[model samples]
Every structure is written in structure tokens, then in C-alpha cells.
Target chain A: EAGVAQSPRYKIIEKRQSVAFWCNPISGHATLYWYQQILGQGPKLLIQFQNNGVVDDSQLPKDRFSAERLKGVDSTLKIQPAKLEDSAVYLCASSPRRQSFFEQYFGPGTRLTVT
Target chain B: SQQGEEDPQALSIQEGENATMNCSYKTSINNLQWYRQNSGRGLVHLILIRSNEREKHSGRLRVTLDTSKKSSSLLITASRAADTASYFCATDAAYGGATNKLIFGTGTLLAVQP
Candidate 1:
């Protein structure tokens, strides 16, 4: 079975520039998530989507970061006017469902380097 | 915020040796999971232990959870060069009416020499 898929394995942008990343989760999975991993640090959850609806986004930076999963199969995460601190790997993961415990399948991730 | 913190930020050992990593968390959790990430790659789930369970074994990996101490440990026996990677422990905390979220630890960088 194919795993989660992400686009643009690597990205570089200047400070204040905008950047966007895309994710296509595993087939039949009902839950999707976006996480940010800084160098030498563990990944932090940014947002979660359950079938076209947001399940949690309390940690998301409302001012600069936004994500959407319109059809519940694919999702996109955007960061506008990026900052130096935004230079980190963006990971996308998917699970079978949200109502129970299930292992998450992660994508290769997009490594964003903001100069 | 990271829910768990792994001890001994890094470890180096020769092949065929045993490697152990510990993780401690602050809040109550439903389950704890371990994941491995190779250089510049995404994380792969290694094992998961529910709070009610004490220990679980999967091949060369053994996981022990102590809820009373709010800590968990991962033991990899007969480690190999292929086991060189970063191991992270993630906690699944229940919130907002049965929904859960996973918060990862700082990670332990393991280097196994062949």
C-alpha cells in the first residue's frame, strides 16, 4: 500500500515571502495532520483535519499559517510572509480514523529554508 | 509544547550491543508510541503501548511503560548499523470529548557502528 505523499520535498524562500506545501494522504484514511519540526527538536502538531473538517488547530499560528482540506483526501498548508523562525520541516501524516487509536503514516515532508 | 522528553540526547554503540532510551512525560496519556526517523526522512512508527499495558515486545524492540512513574523506555537488543536513527516517544492525550492528539519528545539520536 502506498504511504502518504507530499509535494516539493525541499523549499527555500526569503523572509517575508509566502510559501505553500501540499499533502495527499493514504487512501481511505479519514484523518490528516500537519506538523512542524525544527532542527534538533521533535515535531509539533500544527493542525488536524478529519474528513474536510478541522478537528484541532489550537497550536496553529493564526496570523501567518493556515491549512485546508477541501475534499478530505488532499490538504495544503500555507505560510504567508515567512520568517526566519519558519525554517523547518513540514510533515504531513494520516490515520485510518479520528474516533479511535490508529498508527499514523507520515509523508517525506517538505524542508523549508527561509533565509 | 512537547509532552515527553527523552534522556541522553545521543548514544553511540557498536553493533550487536544493546541500546536503551527513556522518555518521561508530564500529563496523563492514553497511549505512548515510539517512532524512528532516519536522516532527512519522515518518522516511522515503531511501537505503541497503551496505558493499561505494562510491556510489549516486537522483534528486537521491547517497550516498557510505567504509569505510576509517568515514564516509558525502549530497549533495542542486538542493535545494528541499520538501527542508527533518531527515536522519539509520542504521547496520545485525550482532549475535547474523546479526540486525541500526539505530542512528540525531543528524541534520542542513536548511532550504531558496524
Candidate 2:
């Protein structure tokens, strides 16, 4: 079994530029999540999806951030007009289900550096 | 805002010693989990303790949860240099009909000297 996979382990962009990150979750996992982890801080949930349907995205920045899990296997998170505050590691995780006991598997995050 | 907050932002100890980290949460939760992250890598789940349980052990890791106090602690005994990493606690918020979203705490950076 493979762990969650993410692309472009590191990224750098200028302020106001657009950037996107991709995630491929573990096989058979039914839930996926995107989180933003600022330096010296815990991860903040951006969005969550269950089998291609969004389960929660209340914390997502609708004006600048968006994510999609089209096939329920792979997902993408995008940030447009990036700001200096957006410079943080974006982590992707997946779980077997919404059950409380299921441990989530995380991917190597994409460290975005916004200039 | 982080749902959980860990105490003693950093800890340094020698190998074969014990390292303890504490985490406190604001709201009720179904379960609490601990994860470890090596430098510049993803987090790896270490242990999970349900609210109904008081303690759990996996190898050298021991976790204790106190629902009444709304806090949890992780104890790593006989630590090794390989155990040097950032440790975080995540809470599964107790909410009706809400997915099990793990809200993480500010991590504790542990450095074990060999």
C-alpha cells in the first residue's frame, strides 16, 4: 500500500500570482482533506471531500482558494492572487472514512513560498 | 485558531531519557491523535486514544487522555536520536453530523541528543 502522494514538494511564486497543488490519496480511501500549515503553527483545514462530494469547506477562503476532487481519487487545491500570508506548507491527507477511529494518512506537503 | 495548544513549545533531552508533551483543547472531542513529522516531511500517525479510553500504548509510546480536563499527553520513554521531530496532537471535534475533522495543535519540537 502506498501513502498519499503530492506533487511539487516545493514551490515559489510572486505575490498576486496563481498557483496550484495536486494530491493523490491512498487507494480505497474514501475521504480526502487539504490543510494549510503556517510556520510554527498547526495545520488549518481548507476543505474536505468524501467520494467526490465536498463534506466541509467552511474554512476555505472562497475569494482566493478553491479545491476539487473530481474522480474521488485525486484532488487539486488552487490559490489565485497569492499573498505573502499564503506562504505556507499545504498538506494533503486521506482517511478510510469519516469514522472517528480512522487514522488519516498524510502526504509530503507542498511548501509554497510566495514572494 | 488552533483547536488544541501544546505546552513547552520545545524540548531537548538525551537519548534513553523520557520525553513528555501535553495538549489541551477547548471543546469536546471524540478522539485525540498524536503525529510525528521529520524535518520537511509529512506527518506520521503515532497513536490515537478515544475519549472513552484513559490510556493506550504502542511500543515505546504511551498516550493518556483526560476528558474531564479536556487534555491529553504523550509520553515517549527511552527516546532515541531518531525520535527527534515535531510532535502534534489532533482532536476529533465532537459535533453532530460533522465529519471527523482532526484539528491539530501547535507542535512540540523535540530534539534528542545521541
Candidate 3:
């Protein structure tokens, strides 16, 4: 009955440094998503997972950002060699199914500040 | 790479007034959804309207979708200060059936003064 959970509500790191965020989706959720939201802009989908397999990663910056949903229950997003542009809030969301038209439940998000 | 753009980037209105925000997207979509985000929090789903639906309503919220115009509008009637937040519209592409990927628009910031 719990909502999606995320850790390290805030993070600060220098350019070229690396950081990782953890997320636990609601019980029985089958879809997980990672999004990046810049100041004054909408959240952009970075990656999506259905169960333990990836459903989409078309917008992910493979060279610097990586995410994995192990066992289809928890997910971790990592950013290596962080850039100034990467300073934004990272959001984790989940849905009961992989089907469309379902509303997503989101976590509080991790705000990253890259200097 | 944003798909939708909301009009009137920001709005300030008094409580009990009606606030309307419009969103226009570039691609065909299977459905459109609206979400709200507070100053320092994650987003909350407000409503979802399918492509076949021209209008939908929730408590104090009315959503109208015009697929022919690739536009949608969200109207909050008798708004309250607690309704102050950023409103965003999202869409899932209709290319090969509806997928889980959602494209969000630049949100509209609404402030309701009590």
C-alpha cells in the first residue's frame, strides 16, 4: 500500500563526479520509469522498464546515464562524469501495468546539483 | 525535444476564479494526461482523456481534447489556493499502438491567491 520511494532526496557533486539514486516502486507495480526534469521544463523520460526487462531507453544518454531495474522491483539510476547540464531533479515513477493510458505514481525525486 | 507547449507560461488568479490552461502538441497521440507538481515535490496525476474522448471532468477540473487541432485545455473551476502548482500535459504516441513512453510539455505555473 506504500507509494513509490526514492533515496538521497538531495545530492551535490562536482563536474566529472559520479552519483547514483535508488528507487523502490509500489508493491505489484509492473512498470518503472526514470525521468529528468530541468528548471522550468517538463520532465523528460530517460528510460522505462517493464518488469526486469527494458521497454524503452531512446532518450537516455548512454555515455553518461545508466539505469537498471533488478528483479523488477527496485531501480537504480547512475550518472557518471556528471555535467553541469545534468544538474536537475531525477524522478522515478511506476504504474500497475505496462499498458498505456494508466496514470503513473511518482516518487519525491532526487535533486542533483553538479558544479 | 519536447512534444507539447503550454500557453501562458504562468497565471495568477484569485480564489473562486476559473483558471484555464491550454496545451498544443505536434504528434498524434493515443491519449493525453494532465499532472500537477508543487514547488518542491514529485508530480501527481490529475486526469487522463483518451483520444476518443472529446471532454472529461473531475472534481473542479474539466479537460477538453481536440485531436483535430492537436490541442487540449484544462479548466479548473472555482479554484482554491491549494490548487496552486505547475500543470503539465503529457501524451503517448499513437504510432504503433499506445506505448508506455510519455512526452511531456513545458508546464504552466498557476498561482491562486486566497
Please give me the DockQ of candidate 2 compared with the native complex.
0.76
- Model 2 residue pairs with clashes: none
TM-scores of the candidates in the order shown = 0.98, 0.98, 0.98
Model 2 stretches with alpha carbons more than 4 Å out? none
Q: What is the DockQ of candidate 1?
A: 0.70
Candidate achieving the largest DockQ: 3
CAPRI class of candidate 2? medium
Off by over 4 Å in 1: none
Q: Pick the candidate with the highest lDDT.
A: 3
DockQ, every prediction: 0.70, 0.76, 0.82
Please tell me how candidate 3 rates in CAPRI terms.
high
Runs of candidate 3 exceeding 4 Å displacement: none
lDDT of 3 by residue, B1-114 (tens): 899999889999999999999999999999999999996656999999999999999999999999999999999999999999999999988887778578999999999999
What is the C-alpha lDDT profile of model 2 across B1-114, one tens digit per residue?
798999879999999999999999999998899999987556999998988999999999999999999999999999999999999999999997446899999999999999
Q: Write the per-residue lDDT of candidate 1 for residues B60-113, one digit (tens) a residue.
A: 999999999999999999999999999999989755544547999999999999
